[model samples]
Target: MTTPPDWSKEEKAVQAVQMAFDLSNDIQRAFRVSAALQDMSTSDMVRKVLQLPYQKNRARPRLTITLKDEDFELLAEKYGLDPLDRATIRHRVSEDLRAFAGNYLTES
Candidate 1:
């Protein structure tokens, strides 16, 4: 059977760095892993070391919230729907709002 894409040495190095460890150790482990696993690129090797969810996963944009869990819960309860279920509903609402706003948002 044909093979899947392999991780490169550099990829491995990066992955090791991302792990919860010292920077020097991560770099060393990365090289060792790349050689042991026969990774194609350091990039790919890093992906393997980290056991990341996807091969081509790009960074997600982050949204920061200053609210504490208790405070957030109180706010969420006031709005309706348990905080636990808000994530899914919020995504749908966000998409709908974006589509409705569309070019009008940019024009103004």
Candidate 2:
């Protein structure tokens, strides 16, 4: 098991800063695909590529993704929920993810 970076430590303080870089769409897709194949997050993959120490299990253990208004509308239609209800949509998405992981584990 790997340990997450300690923000309280001065040497690991830099890890507190969030950073982003512009990359080509193809590169982004490829990187995501590779990470998924290895069952790792893209952040962990980037850390691995840079030879930086990273934890497999993060302190927060939560997944996040940016979604647009259009995405919410689409998801609402797919799930037969009200588009304006963001909280319910979020809860439904979480439930779907949990169900997916359960199904995947049983199949494997």
Candidate 3:
């Protein structure tokens, strides 16, 4: 099978240690939504908000979000894509972020 054109292979490093916060639901949702609208992952968003140095030239430059089976089902239905096609679902989500940012700019 041919690799999808949108997918790129990258050399990955050992996983970095992750830090998670236990924010109130409202706060977490607000933070996550704000980042999504800006086409940033929460990690990058937090780094920017805290005035930390931006890490450049990442091995893989991509946004990530944890999704449950229900989310995949919902998003697949929303995008009219097959539920089993995770790669396509991911591409659709990235497209959605761009669309959200575009709409947000006109509204602002």
Task: Tell me, by lDDT, which candidate is best.
Answer: 2
Using lDDT as the yardstick, the better of models 1 and 2 is 2
TM-scores of all candidate predictions against the true structure: 0.28, 0.51, 0.43
Worst 10 residues of 2 by lDDT: 54-63
lDDT measured at residue 106 in model 1 versus the true structure, 0 to 100? 59
* Candidates by lDDT, descending order: 2, 3, 1
lDDT of 3 by residue, 1-108 (tens): 977664233322334456888889998888788777776766777887889865433446565689999999999999998999999999889888988879757563
List runs of model 2 lying over 4 Å from the truth.
Answer: 1-57, 106-108
On lDDT, the stronger of 1 and 3 is 3
The alpha-carbon root-mean-square deviation between model 2 and the true structure, to one decimal in Å, is 7.6
Model 3 Cα shift for residue 102 (angstroms): 2.1
Q: Sort every candidate by TM-score, greatest first.
A: 2, 3, 1
What overall lDDT, based on C-alpha atoms, would model 3 receive against the true structure?
0.77
Residue-wise lDDT of candidate 1 within 1-108, one digit each (tens)? Answer: 989677797687887644343469778676667644562444545556678543443344333346566754775676665766667546655565678869566563
- What Cα-based lDDT does every candidate model obtain? 0.58, 0.85, 0.77
